[model samples]
Target: MLENLGNRFQDIFKKVRGHGKLSEENIKEALKEVKMSLLEADVNYKVVKDFIKKIQEKAIGTEVLKGINPGQQFIKIVNDELVELLGGTNSRLTKGVKNPTVIMLAGLQGAGKTTFAAKLAARLRKEGETPYLVAADVYRPAAMKQLEVLAKQINIPAYIDEGNKDPIDISKKAFGQARANNYSYMIIDTAGRLHIDEHLMDELGDIKKAVRPQEILLVVDAMIGQDAVNLAKNFNDKLSIDGIVLTKFDGDTRGGAALSIKSVVGKPIKFVGVGEKIADLELFHPERLASRILGMGDVVSLVEKAQEVVDEKDIKSLEEKIKTQQFDLNDFLKQLQTIKKMGPLGSILKMIPGMNSDLGDLAPAEKEMKKTEAIIQSMTLQERKKPDILKASRKIRIAKGSGTDVSDINKLLKQFSQMKNMMKMLSSGKMPNLGGGMPMGIGRGKNKFF
Candidate 1:
């Protein structure tokens, strides 16, 4: 998502790698580039200034690592600062001491509050909590219906008072309902306006006063850049937001909101909305996000996502298949679907160490993967299990069935053969050191067949 910023910083690091030692002048020059990159990424100017200042101070008189180059040292300093700019550590949801923890969602209109509420409900459900979704946004027409639809999708119970326009009254009644029903958590989706207005503030403030919520989370659109920071500050000044939720981070955002909101609003980003899907919400982790922004990759998050989707039994079966070279087209297609469930290919690849850089531009990779998936899906079960049976005529027929050309089919088959060969080598303990030939690894290596 921060591809532009990542690429710009990568170029800066390449320049610093040529220098033998960090001189004051050279360091300043490098920081200048870094500053430009942040500014271009729409990061807050003051945030950028303070961040660069921290890196410069740390870079000066810093003892270089034994085997690390000056560039790597500079990268380390910047990475640490980036982590600080985003929250330094994970901020978790606060639980209410008593039954039914009340979490009030507040934000401007179109900030995805309702959707995030549903996502939170689903997340809590996954964690074995009985969450009751309260549709308290009585002012907005269809707001209650939206919450109901999402609740139904997630199989969570929703409490709504459609006729009641008073949010505070609805919330009070919903609290009573939660108590009677023994719900562990109560999520109140408050109304939002097109812009911050006195009336909206008054309504939210009254609801907060009446409910005394354990968490007042401000849902913000990450693509709004610095406006998100100002909006968060205003909300925190009034209702005192306990945490922030940055939404739509899966888009091509410059990441300004994520970097600036916490420092400006004095609240941690408790969660982030990565996609529109109900399952796309992720807990905010500063270190992992820092690694992502610097192109260092987040292996921990990668493994966690894999564990979530890949069952232990499935992994055992897949391991057996890999060991026996029985990973045929049917198994391959299944693996592709499993990977698709984890998220976008580019995002998944970014979690692998050094794979982000090795992929270069991922648009082509994503496109090619989609094409391969389409072709595989179009094949018959027999064809999938025994791809060797597909002769030239069959290849043409499959291409037509997949709405692709014969050459496209040939390209996929070739790539599949190469991938199978690589898998065999990897399983047979015959894989070569990729660095011996490929400067960046994989795509240009001696075994760059894939």
Candidate 2:
């Protein structure tokens, strides 16, 4: 998820930050490194060119050359340009002035179109809109069933006509059903092909003609890299997409597509699919993304994910436990699970300030966490609540249950105990400088607690 690019940019920034002053040669070298990074990420060549050009123009001026903090100033300019390239600001979901705004989903097959449809419906539901899902993908019966399954899981109504093969007819009927039922939104999940073809295009065109949808969103795979840009362009050429929804962003994508699509097709990326779960779709925020690309992290997004999964009551209870030193292995396990519910470990780690820069790559960290979680899950409730109850025999049993050696469990328990001690110290006001020392346990550079 732009980890590679973020690392490269961070390294370059470090060199500039180390210098007491900025020179034209150093600035040129830094820009050159940035250009190469963007190109290596597969960002659209034109976009890269324009971006570097803008940064150069702003960076070489007197304001930057004579700035109090020249290195920070240069980074700021690049950040601003990155934000502009990503989309100047957040583009929100469009709701129709009239009832039941129709949002048509368009994309190639296996782009997670059906799943994204369900996610969108669920998101709108949270916003007080009664969204009715229309399974208009009549080409494949499985696609319709998938939508139905997702709809049922989310407790949303899915309008399906399995007997009908024509999507236009199904869509028209679905709209009528929505109107009759007083649904506030109609999300039509249309059919897609493995690749762009005239038959699929014509069918989608017909559906559009019949429904006159207010928003036509193209669901693209971020892992496709530059091809995503091409797909968005083709779709926008034919259907004029109002926005894009990038799926699988949490995958090990270079993030070229997300950066290139909007600039190439002139469409705002409305949402991003960060995980496989139905609750993973997030409304895209360009500024947060800009911060991530520059290795500044996205604390706002991290907090939002935490809020979504951790109820206020749970938070208060956890706080009380931390203050009283009652936070045990059970509470620790619950916190781990809560973080996992937010998303993958790597994605979550990048949201913490300075973590993304220091963790060379988080794939290894994620794998280690999974192993630790497995060991924790193998323990009994009593053992989890009170770690001291685990002696040699219990450790061996837990190790056998978790498919790990005793040492692995020992290390995890030790780390958990240390973390609990730290939390207790902080809560009891015994560690006033804990935040300054650790910085959320991510950043590098002589930060002992981190």
Candidate 3:
């Protein structure tokens, strides 16, 4: 999402590292470039100015200028400042002392508040919390229905007051129902408009007063740039929002709203909507995001994501299969599905150290995975278990069923053979050849992985 800004920062750091030593002039020149990059990224003018100023003060100090690695020291200073600009630490959702903590979501009509509500409920549900979705958006057509459907997808309960038109009344009743049912959390999806208006504010205020929510999260679209920051300020002025939920963070965002909102509006971004999936919501972490923006990658977050989707027992089973040479196409398909559950391949690659901005395009890799899945699905269980029995005629039939050329099927089989060979070598404590022995469609031929 912050690809451009991240690239610029990485370029600037590369130039700094190229120099044998850094002087005050070197620091000044780099900070000037950094300032321009932030401005070009659509960051708020005041926020950019203050950020550059802080870095300048820290970089020019004797502690940094005389450090053994001045370039690295300067980079650390910038990273620290970026973390502070991004809110210094993670802001957790508040849970009141009483039961059934209530959270109210407010934002523009298309800001993804409804979708984020479902995402949040899903996250809480995974945490062993009984979360109930309160469809209080009585204004937008089908808003309640939309929340209900999303809730059903995650197997969470949702309250919809079909007869009630008042959002405040609906929220109050939903809160009562949640409390009576002993739900751990009640997330109210409030109505929004094209823009902030007095009526919208009044209605939200009435709901807040009626429910007395433990937290009021203002959902801001990260793709809107500085407008999102201004919107946050306006909402905070009217409703005193507790935290921010930056939605569409996986879009082609310039990174302005994410960098400026916390500093300008004095609100911590609690969660970020990384994708459209109900499991795509991530708790916002300032240091991890700061590292990503600097092209440092976020290994901590990567490992956390892996832990969330990869089961230990499944891993052990897969390991035993590989060691026993019993892995088949079915097991390979299962591994592919598990990888898909971790989110997009491109986003996953960006989280690895040293793989930050180097991945040019990942479309081919994604397409290859989909094609492999199609071919495997087209094959029968017996074929997956025993690929040796398949001849040219069977290959042609499978290709036709999967809507691919026979050559594609050949390449997939070749790739699968190479993968199995590599696994065999590893299991036998031998190193596999890497020159011409690499998997087809991975780093060789026209169908590169990236």
Candidate 4:
């Protein structure tokens, strides 16, 4: 998500590390590059200034300059400061003492308030809360319908008062209904204007007054750069927003909003919309983001994603199959599906410690995996279990079914055979000959093999 800015930071660190001993001048030069990169990423100028000042104070000190590994020390200082600048810790949703915690979302039009409301509702539901969605965006004709559809998709209850145009009244009634229904949370999606206006603020303020929401979150389009920070400030000034939610965070954004919102608005980024899927909403973590930006990877988040999709029983079964050399095409296909469930291949690889900057175009690799999956799916169950039984006639038939050539089938079988042999060797405590590189299309190539 912050690929551009992250690449820049990695390059700057590489230069700093090239120096055997970092002089003050060398450190200053690196910091200057860092400052320019932050500004170019559309981070707020004042935020960048304060951030650089903090780094300089720590970086030029005797502890860093006299350290055995000055370059590593400097990088650590920058990472620490970056984490603090980005809120230092994750901000969780606030729960009220009473039943049905109310969360009101506010933002300008096209900030993704409606979608984020549904995403948040789904997340809360996954956490065992009976979340009720309330669509109060009366001015927007489609907002109510959209919320209804999303609520149905997530199997959550939604209150859409199409007959009533008063959002404040709609919210009050929804709150009463949610409480009566014994809902754990009620998330109200308030209306928004194309630009900030007194009327819009007044409507949102009235809804907050009527609902007495436990949290008032400002959803912002992260692609809007510094304007997002300013918008959050304006909303906080008028309505006193509790936290910020940066939507479209997966877009080709320079990452200005996420880096600047906390510093400018004095509110933590409670959540970020990574993708359009109902489950794409994620709790913002400052330390994880800092690590990602510095090319250190986010192993904790990657593990969490894995744990969510991979069942314990499935892992045990797979391990047993590999041990017995029975990890056939069926198991291979299932593994592919599991990886796909974790998210995009490129994003998953980026979670590895050193894979961030080295990964070029991953589309070819992703396409190859899909092709392999299709080929495997076209085979019969017996063929998957006993791939050696596929004669010329069967290969021809399978090729036609999968829309691939016979040679493609041969390559897959060859790769699968090598993979099995390698697994056997590993299980026997012997190192397989990796001189031929990884099997399948996993080796380096012009097409950027999977």
lDDT of 2: 0.85
Error of 2 at 112 (Å): 2.2
Superpose all Cα atoms of candidate 3 onto the true structure and report the RMSD in Å to 1 decimal: 2.7
- The TM-score values for the models, in the order shown, are 0.91, 0.88, 0.91, 0.96
lDDT of each: 0.85, 0.85, 0.88, 0.89
Which pairs clash in model 1?
none
lDDT of 3 by residue, 204-321 (tens): 9999899998999999899898999999999999999999999999998899999998899999999999988888899999999989888889999998988988999999999999
Q: Quote model 2's TM-score.
A: 0.88
lDDT of each residue in 377-397, candidate 4, tens digit only:
999999999999999999999
Pitting candidate 2 against candidate 4, the one with the higher lDDT is 4
Q: Candidate 1 regions off by >4 Å?
A: 355-364, 392-397, 432-450
> Between 2 and 3, whose lDDT is larger?
3
- Cα deviation at 313, candidate 4, in Å, is 0.2
C-alpha lDDT (0 to 100) for residue 404 of candidate 1: 86
lDDT of 2 by residue, 208-286 (tens): 9999999999999999999999999999999988999999998989889989988899999999998888888998999
Task: Indicate the residue-level lDDT of 377 in model 1.
Answer: 88
Error of 4 at 384 (Å): 0.7
